[model samples]
Target: MKDTGLVAMTEFLRHPSMVGSAFPATARMVRHMLAPIDWDNVRTAVEYGPGSGRFTFAMLARMRPDARLLAIETGAEFVEKLRASSDDPRLIVAHGSAEDVGRHLTENSLGYADVILSGLPFSTLKQEDAETIMRVTGSALAPSGIFAAYQMRTAVLSLINRQFVDVRQGYEWWNIPPCHLYWASKLRGEGSYEDQIGGSASA
Candidate 1:
């Protein structure tokens, strides 16, 4: 996570499921996961569980200057690192769960995110916690916006499908365990979102 090389043993020990070749992700996986975003049109972007900011910094590089980035991280170390690592004004690092993405957006004066990327280890997350994060993601994404995530397991695919209509997948074999990637686009009014996700659109 520190570089494009193997992640630190300490991090892998704490985040047991984040290991894939003892490396969180390479630049290859990062590029593949973030390929669908519309950089020109994006006004707000978000990232979930950005351990050492692999994809987070990449998004900052390509996004429009006026765009804002809200990074929701649960790890206190990562939260501090991301905040101290950037003075880009556009970046806002929040030390909290992805379930509160709505509040993060509102507090930052951001509408629905034009795109969101996640590196959370869903394979290790509690069922209720994972469900809450995905449901919140659906409500936080703009119509036609992208929600992308990379995982080492297939379990997250079904969860992501329930929220987005158009789903696409990729595989990054550059790592040992092989990362499974998914990016989905939310529909205009994603199927009675109030009933399914229990939130009104902020955009």
Candidate 2:
């Protein structure tokens, strides 16, 4: 990814209809948002709403060479921009809504992924839409998979708590309005899941 890619991303982000029109996530913030991911274990990954490839490019740098990145975006313009910015064989940009995640993977015969990363504006989505997207994302993740997302101030804390055994918050104050990175893992082995939730497995 080049510096100009970020410039174009920032311009698109500033557009009025963009969910993150108020401000784009800075490089520092993107790195912090994705820091908890274990690149070594994530072979097949999906990015929901990759907007300008901020997180997309970061994931590319960290994932294995053979790893595949399926980026789902609804903006036709951003999709073109993402495709033009790079020539990585592992990357595929899908111009569509996050809700199409399951259908896209199914059509490609790509089963549960190792990791699912999202930059979607859940705070702006209707409650039913948000729930559907989360359910689809959860279903698409491997049993031991990790699902990560970022948001500016969300009641999602409660929603995540209900579905995920463990949820950790990573904060980034450098970005305008600042933001919080939420990382949650699908339940794994009995002990591992227990460890993640501090041994409280009531859920």
Clash pairs for candidate 2 = none
TM-score of structure candidate 1 = 0.84
Give the per-residue lDDT digits (tens) of candidate 2, residues 1-203.
Answer: 34545644565556433354345578777776666666777778999978777789889998999788889987766788789988998898888777888888777666778888877767777788888888888888888887887887775666677667767666777787687777787663321222332221111
What TM value does model 2 have?
A: 0.83
Best lDDT among the predictions, by candidate number: 1
How far off is model 2, as Cα RMSD?
A: 5.5
Best by TM-score: 1
Deviation of model 2 at 105, angstroms? 1.3
